[model samples]
Target: MSDYCGGCRYDPKQRVGDHACPYTAGYWSFLARNETEFSGNHRMRQPMQGLHRLTDLDALVDQEKARGSIAP
Candidate 1:
């Protein structure tokens, strides 16, 4: 919950329901920012492969949750 981008440190509420939603931006940015850290990690390699093609955050979260990577 930032004031600019949800993934960034700036999530502006006004940006919330738009195509450029902060959550979306933040989500991608989070991945980009941590790609290297995750790429070689045993737990993230498979899921990381789906990042670029994943547009549904909830679904992605659910998938990861099912894999036991995310906390319930």
Candidate 2:
């Protein structure tokens, strides 16, 4: 969370739920969609490591497909 987001209703730390931040959801979605390409890249390996830890990956994909809304 940033100082700028202090007044925002959505939580930057959340990945799913009604108040979930779109950026967070999109970021995880992007990583999941590109894990194979990022897996071998040392620069992305650290964040990419989280790809395997995710539970409802399919839901993240749905969120990505929704474009801006993080709902569901």
Candidate 3:
């Protein structure tokens, strides 16, 4: 609802696809990359569970890897 986000090309609420925010996508990517390590963490339990529910996780991971080092 902020003025700054009104004309932004990226969507903070989205985790994948053309309009996905780099930060949002990166967050999920980071969680996915370290899923095994964070599996045993109680603090990560909810996030991990949410990560598993993303149907586009594989695609998101691929996209993030391809976007490496590029400024979004």
Candidate 4:
């Protein structure tokens, strides 16, 4: 089952699976394309912040590991 648009499926013939997964490249492209107006949007703001904070994934992972968040 596809997870596009709140777990709803779109037409496979017209759209690709990339549009289904929220983490897909196409999804980010969609978000980037629609970012300007979403500044005031509730959900978008936090993720935008997360996107900014996640720029250093490796360091975040290392920090989490240091904090015993990851299983060895």
* The candidate that achieves the highest TM-score relative to the unseen native structure: 3
2 versus 4: better lDDT goes to: 2
Worst 10 residues of 4 by lDDT: 13-22
Between the candidate structures 3 and 4, which one is better when assessed by lDDT? 3
TM-score, cand. 1 vs. native = 0.39
| Weakest 10 consecutive residues of candidate 1 by summed lDDT | 11-20
- Tens digit of lDDT per residue, candidate 1, span 1-72? 644443554434322233434454455545754788898898887767767566665554554445454466
lDDT against the true structure, per candidate, is 0.55, 0.77, 0.87, 0.47
Pick by TM-score: 2 or 3, better one = 3
Which prediction has the highest lDDT against the true structure? 3
Question: Compared to the true structure, candidate 2 yields what TM-score?
Answer: 0.76
User: Which ranges of candidate 4 are over 4 A from the true structure?
Assistant: 1-23, 53-72
> What lDDT does candidate 4 reach at residue 56?
41
Global Cα lDDT for candidate 1: 0.55
Residue 64 lDDT in model 1? Answer: 45
Candidate 1: pairs in clash:
2-11, 3-10, 3-11, 3-12, 4-10, 4-11, 5-10, 7-26
Clashes of each: 8, 0, 0, 0
Give the alpha carbon lDDT tens digit for every residue of 1-72 in model 2.
Answer: 549888889899877777878778888887877788887889997787687788867876786677653434
Residue 33, model 4: Cα distance from true site in angstroms: 0.7
